[model samples]
Target: MTQQPDTLTESLSLALHYAANGWRVFPLLPGSKRPATPNHRAADCDRTDPWCRTGHAGWEQRATNRPDWITRAWSSNPAYGVGIACGPSRLVVVDLDTHKPGTEIPEPWHRFGITTGADVLDHLAGAHGGTITPTYTVRTVSGGTHLYYTAPDTTRRFTNTAGKIGWLIDTRAHGGYVAAPPTQIGSSSYDVTDDRPPAPLPMFLLDLLSRDQRPTPSTPNDDHNAPQRPSSRPYRPAGCGDPVHSTSAYVEAVIAAETAALNAAPDGGRNLALWVMATNVGKLINRGLITEHAALDRVLAAAAGHIAADAYDTYQAEATIRSGFHRAATKPTTSTRSAA
Candidate 1:
């Protein structure tokens, strides 16, 4: 079923939720009136409004657009290129291309915008192991700073977590633009350096640029129709010649255990049968005997026969098994009298 777009109230509610948690919100405003403004404090915006047209439009064009904008805005930039948007009350970093000019980043290189994430920076610093001196600058964005970095191409991927935020400061490169603070004067510019490119721009970023320059993807089933599954097969990992003996062994053990439990019970409750299977799978996962994905596959395959009638039943059964096992294990076992 198709989901409805969030109402303005819903969007505001979410914006408030992030604000309550101390996230900065950046509102994209169009026109030449202001260089930049904090999003949270910025007045309401409309897609049709001329001021709203300044940032990248690529984001709004995406099938699944995020209200935060940063997520979609940075989708086209270098996977390593990082962007920081500061709202009046929050700040967010994203690893996607900034929207085309008039859509996200206001004008200029907006056409050349790129997306970058946190990992990109980590790779560039060699995680502090390489000789590449990672220099950084903090330019004011509305009320926050856009942390910029100058490193070899080595840090071609952007990486950000709770504590990290920065971007690659490319000097001597045309189309180099920085987001200007609302109050700052003059066009965005950075100083050039003599350091060599640390690493080649990541292939993914290069590919994105090349693809952006090409014709848009062909539409089938009409532009208004929901997306159709592509005829091409989905990508899958290739199998090595060697058998996954460990996986086979785990599956066998689970089957044997379930069979034993089923055979031994005088009155086999569905719960008991489920517990047998789930516990076995959980044990394999805990012991590192099987990958989580493999274990899930096995569980789902086994459930096909037992709880297929009600999918929710299978979910509850699994939850019961996990909780029951943990609770039972935590309590001490009582000694029992044996009959001679």
Candidate 2:
């Protein structure tokens, strides 16, 4: 009888295989996304074990195509999960999750109410042309799949996206990382559905991932017919002989509104307020006062001190801010006139 390979051998071999295939590889905690190395930047672990925590600091830069490094990493501990650095590997992965019965997804995300990874593939084929194809696919533990394809350009910075293209359709691209199969999280594993060579992303899909196809913001509302409210009593539009609608003023208004919302927001409502502020800030970001990243970091820092609810996932917060910011950025820079 043939004996099964030890877990260490299996993990090391898999890591080497990925490196040999030109895919940059790194090790993650056995059952978590945490970097296996003690040097992982985000880890709060004490530096007692120099060897374990001593790598790229985190998955972001830990991936490498070097065979020796991969070997050394796995030889130390074979139970680690294999992570693929997306951009460095020249790959992009579309991650589709199975939505529960009553999630907050957009209405009619799936026109046919389609289900399963296979169904999504079929739908994409017709919608995005023959180019909407995957080079390889991996079945996720959540009944979803990570569809991998080579990127047309590795230089473009792509952020992990959520539900932008459609419902349950997220993307992991540049500046992102993914756990490959054989990386078990408890009793489950990310299993490869196919061993076929990954093909380059179809042009249409590449365009979507490139960030150039982002939706433009609509024209600013004149508020010519807005309902009268108590909030309106304190402020009025710039009267005649006043400066043209100032984006800066508009931005300040947005900040004030958001701060009020943040203070009054109930547990679930704070997240919504954060989302709205990010959108408004995006419209005025061109004023040169702040940046998207800096803005978010500042807000999050404030939340750490002021917010009483559980913090949101970093990616989730970033995605929400990005989507809102991008949409608002496309809007007219001219501020609407206020009636005093």
Q: For candidate 1, lDDT tens digit of each residue in 1-340?
A: 1111134443344333333443333323232222223232224444454434774332112211144553333232211112122322122222222223244432112222423323333332321112323323233322223333322233233323221112322221111233322222234321212222223333322222221111211112233453333312221211323234345432453444343332232323445545544554555565566665455444544443333333224456456556534533443131100000
Residue 262 deviation, candidate 2, in Å?
A: 31
| Cα RMSD (angstroms) for every candidate in the order listed | 23.8, 15.3
Q: Put down candidate 2 lDDT per residue, 82-192, tens digits, no spaces.
A: 889887888778887776776554323343465544454454443322345546888887778888888775556667777544456788876788888867776777888
Highest-TM-score candidate: 2
User: Relative to the unseen true structure, what is the C-alpha lDDT of residue 146 in candidate 2, on a scale of 0 to 100?
Assistant: 87
Give lDDT per model, in order.
0.32, 0.59
* Model 2 misplaced regions, further than 4 Å: 1-5, 38-57, 115-125, 213-222, 225-340
